[model samples]
Target: MRHLCLLVLLAASLAAADPIYVTAFRDPCRAIEVHRLVLANEPVVPLTVVVGGVERQVPAVSVALPRTDWVVHRALVDGLAPATEVTLRFPGTTERVRTLPADLARPLRIATGGDTMHKPEWLAATAKALSARDPDFVVLGGDLAYEDGKNGARVVTWIQTWVASARAPDGRLLPFVSCIGNHEVQGSYGGDITKAPYFYAMLPLGGSATHAIDIGDEVSVILLDSAHTTPIPGPQTAWLAEQLSKRAKRPSIIPIYHYPAWPTVKVSKGEKDPTGNRVSKLIREHWVPLFEAAGVRVVLENDQHTYKRTVPLKGGQPDPGGITYLGDGAWGVDVRRIFPGLTWLAKGAEVRHGYILDIHAGGRIAVTAVDETGKDFDSVDIPAR
Candidate 1:
């Protein structure tokens, strides 16, 4: 995960001497893959990337280097040592550059939900705020941009702004992974994945526009496509079952979508789902069961404006035992209510704000709600291990 730093700082760092940069991620897929864009004025010189004493010369994303902007080149480095520093070096660049450590110890800090983006510095402010504290990575639970599929070109500015937080804290771009939200659907939520052209373009990195990215053997962060491309029961259901089944050993299995299974916020009469609540119904019927069977931790939810955290229950009651579902998304946007009586909620069940989830030395994940004023209002801990 890239820490929060200025792009200019990286450029300046390179100005002194050819700088070797490293971007890191506790990839949901277990191993962390690192990619780099090399820039040098001394013609084209061969470069070799050394990681933890291993040397491999990987190819660039494009043979032709960008004269101005940073170019993206990516590759997966499998079987990596978790909780350890990884480094990257170009021959004779003075010293090697290492990737940053994971944000948490036994667990990791991962904030989620989508559709909470809007306002003047909506994206920028949240990015700056989160960056200030230094988060390992930023995940768009959904609704990254307000663009409603008017045209592929729409949200270009928002895309540019949204991607700033995507950059590594060391100034490298971290992988900004997201699932399909209602706003991402074409025109509205009742559409298919193909209608979200701009989204497909932004996330060309792959995941079927709806796939799961694993964090480690402990956590499986599955991003569902409840929007346009895939449906829950028909095709996606089978895939979701397979993914969950295969990752049964995984301690925590969390899914992020544009819609909500049980919304804390009210739905206006005229409103229809952009991502279909029926999909959540499928998730409730076919998916949540597997989550319980698999010892899943919590599901990162969004779309409805209010704040919510469902009782971690196998059934939707005050069962002393259940999976805690977190989020109704109020990151930057305004919501309708703060929830009535969420007895099952761990915390922030009715707050209108964002939260910072810290994973400690153990697999305990802590949630602290922070308002736009950078104040902490509430906190809770959940065992992610």
Candidate 2:
């Protein structure tokens, strides 16, 4: 009789548990998936979620977060109309998710930045400002959460904060795209994927962190690992070459990564080498050539906490016909100082900001930098090639 009473109490406790964090993501910008990380109070059974009136069962998968009892459930909903709103019904919550448009004729707006979640207040302000812009999606260059790949509770808080603050003006949740940075791993550099467990669990970017996704038919955004978990040379380089080659004729092929090839701040002499030794050098040698050859017009880079835009350059010299690099992070973190006498830099500033890229139908992108106060600080116009 005692064992039966204890078992009844356990079952009742599990039945009353609710989800802690529920958010949606677009992996390839086409497939929409929802992840629900249940609260650690109790273990819950598999639950059914309704996506667009269709019921799908989501099973709970145990997440190995140190000293945490959180479990995650995933549900992928397919065959939805583009640019349309779909309703997602979890047990006690309902969220509206907007799908990316499939038509290339319509203009698209993307807001991007990195090095976020350092200070909670700054992150909330930046997220609110970006949400007010009402962008189609967001791309983070990395250093997200600042969890150091171990603090799972911090990671959970970060996600919850983002989901709460990063909503469109119309109240729809915006999808997220990201790359891995040094802070995402335990070693901070040159470590394997095992070092960044929360990143893999939270953001499912296929298997590898480096991958490419297309928005409509005109633009291709390539997200790179930046030597954090994956090396700059070897198979990643080969994959990059192939992706660029395949999209050679694409109107806009933009690469978003963590480290900058032409850094705004000065790197120590000890970090530079000729044989593609460092992250920046390896990118310049192995990736920049591919980018230049493939006619990549814009590159988004982060890590150094300052805002910077480079002059169009080819072969290390400013040229009218060359790729332009935008950004040195500064989203929700303190700004850094830029090295003086850098000829390649067209514009640089010490400010917390994010980029709003308005991609037109013909591939011309009007880039605008907006600060935490939602004020525009800088603007650049890139013509279609």
The candidate that wins on lDDT is 2
What are the per-residue Cα lDDT tens digits for candidate 1 across 122-193?
666655555555555556666766676553333544544544443436654333467777676666555665
RMSD of 1: 7.4
lDDT of 2 by residue, 1-385 (tens): 9999889867744553433333233433446666666655545544455556776665655454555556455566566667777666666656777777766666788889998878867777788888899988788899888888888877766776787778889987777778998888999999888898888877765568987888777778899989888998999999999999998778888899998897777566665421223678889999999999998889999988899999998988999889889988888998888877777889999999899998887678899999988999999998887
Whose TM-score is greatest here?
2
Model 2 TM: 0.88
Query: Which stretches of model 1 miss by more than 4 angstroms?
Result: 1-106, 151-154, 163-173, 205-207, 268-279, 338-352, 360-363
User: How does each model score on TM-score?
Assistant: 0.71, 0.88
Q: List the residue pairs that clash in candidate 2.
A: none
* Residue 314 lDDT (model 1): 70
Clashes of each: 23, 0
Angstrom error at residue 260, model 2: 0.7
RMSD of each: 7.4, 4.6
